[model samples]
Target: MIRLDTGAITEIALLAAHCDDLAIGLGGTLLTLADSVPGLRVRALILTGAGTEREGEERAALESFCPGADLDVRVLDLPDGRTPVHWERAKEAVGELRRGGDPQVVFAPQRDDAHQDHRLLAELAPTEFRDHLILGYEILKWENDTPRPSLFHPLSEVVARRKAELLMKHYPSQRDHDWFDEESFLGLCRLRGVQCRARYAEAFLVEKATITFGGA
Candidate 1:
């Protein structure tokens, strides 16, 4: 079990099909980055929930999740769960994000995700971020779409607890849902932590990565 450093990650890109997806998938990772890397720049794109309460929730949650980071986020009006129907618009949006900047890493959903919206974005993101490190994060929903992620971001017990707390506090709109509970969020971290031999951790599916040993 070798430990690796997330070297000089000054900027990152986050892609999600809907609001809260990024937070649910890697909220703890965001927190860890914000704490370790001061002034981290983050650019995020969500295909749905523009001009709605869900969008508002996302903005606030990200701010809290990535405290002290320069964050730019966009939530589009594309209809949720029907991403394939609006393929052109989604593709253009992703291209626009690529034009914005080149991030050191990209976070996205799994290409084989059960949810069509997640899957579509997962498939499309690589087209734009071809040479970047892209880590696929998983959303724990009703669908049996749990990913067998090879990469694990180890999280402290405190950070893990805060992720669950912010999730409950910021997204009041999602409170009605059964899965929107502290237990479910922390439980996933606990389960993944066991795999990585940590107190708590967040898992990521890595499609590709280039190792530069000894600083290349």
Candidate 2:
């Protein structure tokens, strides 16, 4: 089991095309990180949410999900479902955010995802963040598209359950939908955890990888 001493990571950034994309994709992982570290910083960059109802919902949800940490949220008014068309703007926005200092880790979508927006974001991310670690979180909607994830982080059952609860509590828009519920979220975590023999887990697809060994 990969027991990450989350205290080691001070800053984390998550990039997504929509409001719930980050939560749906890496909510459990984020929760685990927050719990593991006392002063971890987190940022969620939403490429869409331009004058939409989802924008307010995202704001509320993020505040609830990440309580103590410095939650930096930037909702770009870019057209939804058209990230590939406006790739330059997306890259520029990301570049502007990481100018002063870079986040220790960044989580974004896979380059070959079913959704064009996700794929585009993944492509643009590399342009700005060439040296840092980039993790691609998966969303199951468009299709059960799996990209052979290279990194897997196990979340405690408590963390997994809390992630689901936060999703339900924060997103009122999704509650009416048949798919948004406590059971399905837990089920997904359990299933992913099975891949690494953990009770609950979140998985990521990686475009590049680097590792250094510190003697145990």
Give per-model TM-scores: 0.97, 0.90
Model 2 deviation from the true structure expressed as Cα RMSD, one decimal place: 2.1
Error of 1 at 177 (Å): 1.5
* Leading candidate by TM-score: 1
Model 2 residue 93 distance off true place after TM-score fit, in angstroms: 0.6
Q: How many backbone clashes are present in model 1?
A: 0
lDDT of each: 0.93, 0.81
Clash pairs (backbone) in predicted model 1: none
RMSD of each: 0.9, 2.1
lDDT of 1 by residue, 26-107 (tens): 9999999999899999999999999999999999999999999999999999998788999999999999999899899999
TM-score result, candidate 1: 0.97
Q: Pick the candidate with the highest lDDT.
A: 1
